[model samples]
Target chain A: METVDLKSAGFGSNKVIEWGIRTFGKIVTRLLLQADVVALTIPKYVELLRREYGAQNVLLAPHGSFEDNAVMPSFEQGAGPIKIMTFGKFGTYKRVETLIEAFAQLQAPEHKRPALELVIAGTDSPNAAGYLAQMAQRYAHVPNVRYTGYVSESDVPVIFGESSVVVFPYTSTTGSSGVLHQAGDYGKAAVLPNIGDFAEVIREEGYTGEFFQPNDVDSMAQAIARVIDNPANRKAIGMQNYRAARGLPMEEVVDWYMLHFETLLDEYANRKGKIGLAKA
Target chain B: MQIIEEITPEKLTLRLSGRFDAHETPQVRQKFTEHAPKNALIDLSGVTFLDSAALSTLVQAMKNCRERGGELTLANMPQPVRIIFELTRLDKAFNIVNAPDAP
Candidate 1:
């Protein structure tokens, strides 16, 4: 079997791999305690695995970030089209149906909608496929609604560069989202639900984004309309977000993980020493 | 952790201080068993912090006091302690007073 060392994977690349490895590793480790595993990416995940299924059973494997050659053109001048994008598995938490209803209301003739397009991207969860199918049928007649079932990570910059704003309609209290971080890094003005760490991240940067009550369709519609109607404000906010995101280099985030790991390892070593002394 | 029990004409007050966490639950539970009072009031004015586990203990205590034919009320909650209650939606479940010393 090919070996991987997650710790040595260059910072940005390591984190992406770690996210996946740690998430899956926990599930697999709990099922098969004696399975030999290689290259665990996340330290917290590894720590949890070790606690449940002895430290010797797992290995850390990290890989460098993939290099994609596709080039993206910079945002053009003038009031660009209001292209709103949301990518995620279709689920109750993502609240995609709420966005669809909101967009449908915007497209109503009475609203006098601006030049706007709503793109729903990402693979729909199997359980939510029926819900997604219902949305597709209901919003079939709505103008400027596009759904891309899935988009590869390499093509993300292309999507963001062509779009003016991104929306995260997630409705949850815990768990972190990589999409929120990705949108920040790409400098796309975002509209997100006010909850959990999202509130902390948005509030800290002073970015030009609005928070609406979770699951409130009318509030979401208003926030979306505000971003689409005002181009100058959108660009200003996007730029501020990009600047703020740049400060949190992936290397620094990984350094935090490394420090945590070192602390855990030292504690384990000291505990083992005490046990040995007692036995002696 | 310390629990100072005082009975007033208006309410039965228990003044709690020090850090409250999961491990301290059993001790608090034992104390409640000994000094179980009707119309109990808990003053968390001196509590530095409270976690979800501690909140569970408070909920259990409230239920115990209510079962004895009286109400359980909380008084003088600090900001951090209040936040735990708010986040867990326990604020709606408890009768919280701003100041325990107030008449």
Candidate 2:
């Protein structure tokens, strides 16, 4: 959850329920002990949770990208052609149907529209094969749409390299997305909804974030168009994203976690020392 | 980068799209020097960024054009590009104007 979501919950029924639950938990007293430190993927939620729980033992550890930094493949180039792709599992939360519907409705010349390739990449499973079949049938008439049912870990970088833009049409999510970091690693601009930590990731990645209304096809199309139309902005934003990703490489994140671990251990040791002295 | 060129009896106007940086400055410089136009107007509204190298090339082109008793002016500068000029005080040195008069 974003800071606003946690902060905006009113002190009415929701707060009443929360208070009631806290009272019940305190009365029951299953456990009063807390973890030595709390780790959360999204920084905003970490702060809100810390304040709510009145505990400062919280660590903000944003997710890291893949350790392998092999040079990515070249993006679609030259004038008159553009390619937009999305990578992830086929799930209800992804809202990928919105992207397809918008692509079908986009008003452009056949020659030009064909320039826009929509690649929905994911490994098929029992959960989504039926939904994927429906989408394929629905857009059977549309051109330049490629659906790679399953992509291996080795091929993820290659797929990212071939595209100019990555669309994250998520309708709902609990935490930050690794996809944002993955796309950033390739210097690709992400068309994401302005919700939760999506916006924060975009901001941290500088010029790579393009936002649309959640679950709106027209809004997603417009957002994608904004990046496609301006070749220079698109390239510049991609480079900016690359620079941002470089700052938080895998090794750096590991080092940060190690440091946080040390802080926790020291705090624990000091507490033990005080208790021992008190007992004497 | 895309360069939109126009050759009228009076002068030459080149509208540059994308980034005007070191990577593109040479091409831009060549466009200005290949044929010396009496009055040069480079439309920059479409440009998203302009680095110091680009700034230097523009200054050089302006100097050359003036040597021939003409001026090299930039018009329709995007805000981000315009801020570079203002911050460097190049806005005073160069013939920078609104977009309407640029094209």
Candidate 3:
């Protein structure tokens, strides 16, 4: 099985580095295309690979969610600081400054902001080191803003459990989002940009979310406000997400893959036997 | 990290200790590949910390084992190390158990 989550050939401000990345990406893409069957998490990637790279055997393997754990707090029990959390590797495409700014904007009297805490979970992208630190320094005065550095797997439930709403502060997409799947698994309403893979996944996967234009702080603030302001709306979307996550559990996806592999193996054996018979 | 291997007719268990980070992943990968047990149990009780590189190594090893009609089960995980799996939701992908006394 091959994943088509290609690293961007064009990011950062360095021309030489960008060219090198582009070169490496081409090599990796060539190698990936050589696979008997290439599995892509995003449907768009499958189309792109087939159309752009002339890859014939691309398969759309949707990102799978785990079975529902009791770790998530019940929707009714979602009280406290009204935590608006975003979990991902920060900087580059998945920057948090926009979310932080939007969270700050959501605090305005005009928006009738509720008691909220902006929780930034996970560390900086490997290419963008010290990014979270810079963001922290930049928005140091923003009250109730908490930065959780490199959250471990176990802490995920607790962190997600505490959140009132999950936000995706991504400026762009990099394949199907595990964080989005995690948010759905944990039964949290999402607020995200209505663009690229985010739009595609929401449409394909039956995830309901409050969407705002990318990089628009006001739009983001208002979108987030819509959910946090109404418990009923939040619960409805969260419930839908929970159902969607249950619909395609990772175990079922793996079983599907095993079936496909079995077919491939059978065909391979038949081909080998035919070759042997011809030689005889 | 130290990997103590115990191979029985039923399965192969590897008891690991210390930080399972990027630095130690190469050796871990090599050891797992060398053993290539069909039914494998990795006892992570003694593991203090885990990094992304180590996680990737285990994932690749799990896939390789699964391809060979075997499975990888994580056993006796410490809370800290377990959290890493939970955060990535990898705990679901892997068969995890707390059966400490299993022979």
Candidate 4:
């Protein structure tokens, strides 16, 4: 089972419902212990599972950068407005209120910078059916906020490529972030919350970015400003991230999985041979 | 890309230089496997860049060496090339020795 942090799933606020969800999660984890190997995307979870549940079969299989054909644009060439974007399923833990509010704050008359655009790309989470629509209505007065509903696979590159900085307006992280990897693949600087799995990914994956305190508009705005105010720093961070992504492409990750499966096969064959000898 | 090889009965050391990327990987893999030495050492003093495809090739070579009851050791890794191994956390998997800096 790939690791999932149930606490971040936002099951419910009710005490009884939270308790029941926790129980269900524990049962699921227990079932996972019976599997041949429980793969965890985050490195910290490998130790956590082994200590908490005494899960011996747990192994760390880190998330890989998605295969992309997006030609990395020269950061120096862009003359358009600095577009700040947050992509992926929104609402629940991945809230965008802080980001939108921060963008509104960043666009205030007092802060002097180039023209800015806020692109909230992608749809709402299943649990958050009308979250984006509600956000669009709530922040209707905020200028230049475009909600590109359901970004197509072909357009994923275009959305990421055009953006100067990618923001993660998450209340909490549920798992290893695919969006972050996408940001790295596209050579875009990230403004992320300095918490939990985000920290772990930075430490283990060598992805450097501007960090803000979760749920704080001023902090988020300041973090975004840090990247926007300086083009050299943005390009440097983006280049470092691109190099990091190039270091661990998905093909290398697949090879690691294949090798692990081969090891498991060898173990199984030995066990089968021992059982056959005992039966004879 | 340049690969200088030194082969002995027990060990094979291949010194790689230039950009060790996808373009150079096939030749490196061929040189590393041709000898099939139990113990191998990859000297990366002259390598300017190490891409993911090259990393995968090294990983395969390491696996092959281990399966033969020996180990593949990395030596004289330059800082930039070494960062790739460190960032990917592959530094912990292979036996890396900080040999004296290349002259």
Local accuracy of candidate 2 as per-residue lDDT tens digits, A8-116? 2221237776566556654443233166555665556555655666655555554555644647534445343466888876645664678987776654574264366
Once superposed on the true structure, which residue ranges of model 3 sit more than 4 Å away at CA?
A1-10, A67-73, A110-112, B1-103
- Please rank every candidate by TM-score, starting with the best: 4, 3, 2, 1
Candidate 2: give its CA RMSD in angstroms. 16.8
Q: What TM-score against the true fold does each predicted structure earn?
A: 0.51, 0.60, 0.69, 0.79
Residues A1-280 of candidate 1: C-alpha lDDT, one tens digit per residue: 0122333222125677677876676676566655433334333344455565565444322211122222322433225556788977775456577787787777778878667788888776654556566678877877888887788877777677677778888766333456665665777788888764567545433344767777788999888777777777677667666644543445433443343354456667899999999999
What tens-digit string does per-residue lDDT give for candidate 4 at A87-170?
999888888888989999999988887799999999998977998999999999999999999999999988988999999998
Docking class of 1: incorrect
Query: Candidate 2, residue A83: CA error in Å?
Result: 2.5
DockQ (Cα-based) for each candidate: 0.01, 0.01, 0.02, 0.14
Question: What TM value does chain A in model 1 reach?
Answer: 0.66
Kindly give the stretch of ten consecutive residues in candidate 4 chain B with the minimal lDDT sum: B84-93
Where is the poorest 10-residue window by lDDT in model 2 chain B?
A: B84-93
Which candidate's TM-score is highest? 4
**Deviating ranges (above 4 Å) for candidate 2:** A1-33, A72-81, A110-114, A124-129, A205-207, B1-103
Best by DockQ: 4
Rate residue A230 of model 2 by lDDT: 72
Model 1 stretches astray by more than 4 angstroms: A1-80, A108-113, A204-208, A275-280, B1-103
Instruction: Summarize candidate 3's per-residue lDDT along B1-103 as a digit string, tens digits.
Output: 8988887767778899998765677787787677777778888999998754466567767777788898878889999887656544456467789996453
- Candidate 1 chain A weakest ten by summed lDDT: A61-70
> On a 0 to 1 DockQ scale, where is model 4?
0.14
| lDDT by residue (tens digit), candidate 3, A1-280 | 1222233312635768556766788788889889777777666677677777887666665566865344444876356778999998887778787888888887766766667899999998887899899999999988899998989988988898899899998777766788888888888899989877788887666688999998898899889988998889999889877766755556556664664576567668899999999999
For candidate 3, the docking band is: incorrect
For residues B1-53, could you state the per-residue lDDT of candidate 4 as single tens digits? Answer: 99888888878888888988755788987886688878888899899987656
